[model samples]
Target: MRYVFFNHQGRAVLGVRTADGVKVLGEETLESLLERGVDLVTYGANAQGPSVEIGEQDYLPLMRKPGKIICVGLNYADHTKESPYAQPDYPTLFPRFNSSLTAHNKPLVRPKVSDTLDYEGEMAVILKSGGRHIPKDQALEHVAGYALFNEGSVRDYQFKSPQWTVGKNFDDTGAFGPDLVTADELPAGGKGLLLETRVNGKIVQSANTQDMLFDVATVISTLSEAVTLQAGDVIVSGTPAGVGFGMNPKVYLKPGDVVEVSIEGIGKLVNPVIDEA
Candidate 1:
């Protein structure tokens, strides 16, 4: 089942999408509910709250301030070739602060310091439970669900240094959410799914989840060996090729552009571009 969690009346309103409409589940982030041992996949079958129409209001960060936001870079071989860096033997991971996150349908701000805002349409998984030294075979058990993300980057700032934190962490750049599709609804490890990205109704990046050099199971297992993975941590699987920065003219986002990232079995995450005021 698919579920949309947005903020309403200072409440973390979570609702499951049904044939009738969106039926409210509770006023808590999905991560929090999973931490409390609530079974989201099956609980909504009978249990539910009032139905409400949620709009783009309070900024919903999907996991809602999830403890860890781990991002993988250059996971796709084709994307790695387009990138300045070489393909890595292991996953290249990065971190994102909560301030950088924006909700679905929200505006992706182009900061005044630089106008090289680039989009990396990606798929991310939220952890239900986490632990250290997790084996690859059992990693999928920890995934709560999957969501779409526009990992907006300020290219000029990003290439200024080897470390990508500054360019990647600008406030209100990362677009997340729309809905969380439970793991059971999709193929194992989110494989065999087509991930396509579009800008202003034009297709840009397109690839399948199976093309990742480091898949979900491997990323989780590898990360666990070094750091303790906690419940609510999100692992954003990297984007495919066709980022504007890789283009000959190096296209960048400006005001009035709409960016969309859609994955099969999941839903579309769209955001309009606007200059930082």
Candidate 2:
């Protein structure tokens, strides 16, 4: 089942996608429901609340506040080739704070400090349960669902130092939802799906999940070895080639540009670019 968090009457409400409209689950957010071990399959079976027209409500990030947002860099072979750094055997990971997250249809803030705001379209895996030292083979069992992410970057700040935290954690730069497509709805580990990014109606990045250097299973297993993977922890599976930084004439986002990140089965996450006030 697809799940979403939306603003209704100035309050955040959790809802499940239905054939007619979005079925209201409760006022509790997605993270809260997951924490409570709410059985999504049966939670709203006898719904008595009002259904909201999908496009009429304002969207919120799938999880308003995730415990952690772990991002993998250079996990795609094609992207690694376009990058300046040499491909490494291990996944290059980074942390993105919840402050950076924006919802689908929200505006991505392009900070005034630089005009090099770039986009990294990737698939995000949301964990259903918490665990540590998880085995690679069983990692898929922990995934709750999959969603799309636009790992928007402030290129200038990113390269300011070896650490990418500064650029990656800018408020409202990252766009992360529409709905979370349950893991069962897609292929195992979200593999074999087509992931693409389009900027203002033109395709910029295109690749298959199978092309990822380190698949979802490996990432989960590896990450779990060091940190306890918790429910609501998001793992952004990295982007493919064709980012603005990798282009001949850098094509950074400008005010009024619309960026759409689409993953097969999950759906498209669209956001507009706006100058920071």
Candidate 3:
């Protein structure tokens, strides 16, 4: 079932999209629902007031807040080729602080500090529960679901400094949602779908998840070995090539540009670019 976080009567709540419209999930966002141990069924009510419309409600980040946000870099062979260094044998991981998470359809601000803000369309896996030293075979079992991920980046900061934190963990930069879908509802793991990115309706990046250097299962398993995976933590797999920095002329985002990231069977997430005011 498709689920989204929407604002209702001055508060954020989870809603399920149905033939009747959005059925209010509960008094709070999905993160709250899980925290209170509320039955998922309780969120569904029978035709309350006029059913609220999707996109009409103010959106909160799918989880609102997560204990940790882990990300992988150059997990795609194509992205590695674009980098200025040699590819590593293992995943190059980084921590994207909670401050980076943003809701879908929101304006992604290009901070005055960085001039080369770029977009990296990616697929992310959300952990449903906590597990440590999780085996590779059981990694997929722990996933709650998937979401469309737009890894908005500051290329100048990323390449200028050795550590990626300054470039990656910017405020309201990481975009995930429309909704968090259950893993059972999607195709098995990593071999099923095409993920693409478009800027202002023009395709800038296109590739299949099957091309990922380290598939979902491998990423989860590897990361779990180092850190305990929690219920709301997100693991952004990686993005394909065709990033602005990789282009011949090096295209970057400007005010009023709309960026779209889509995954088959998951959903699409679009964000507009705005100057820091």
Question: What's model 3's lDDT at 208?
Answer: 92
For each candidate, give its TM-score against the true structure: 0.96, 0.97, 0.92
Query: Which parts of model 3 have CA positions greater than 4 angstroms off?
Result: 33-50
Question: Global lDDT of each model?
Answer: 0.89, 0.90, 0.80
Candidate 3 lDDT trough over 10 residues, lowest sum: 38-47
RMSD of each: 1.4, 1.2, 2.3
For model 2, the superposed segments whose C-alpha errors exceed 4 Å read 44-48
In model 2, the clashing pairs are: none
Query: Please, what's the RMSD in Å of model 2?
Result: 1.2
What's the TM for model 2? Answer: 0.97
Candidate 3 local lDDT, residue 166: 80
Q: Please, what are the lDDT tens digits per residue for candidate 2 over residues 10-108?
A: 777888888789888778876777777765556656566777776533999888888889999999988988888999999999999999999999999
- lDDT score of residue 219 within candidate 3: 84
Q: Tens digit of lDDT per residue, candidate 3, span 1-277?
A: 5678778787777777778787775666555555444334334434254467766337777777767778889987888898776888898899887788788889888988887889999888877675778888888876767888889998888876788888897787788788777676787674668989999999999999998888888888888888877777788889999899888888999999999999998889999999888
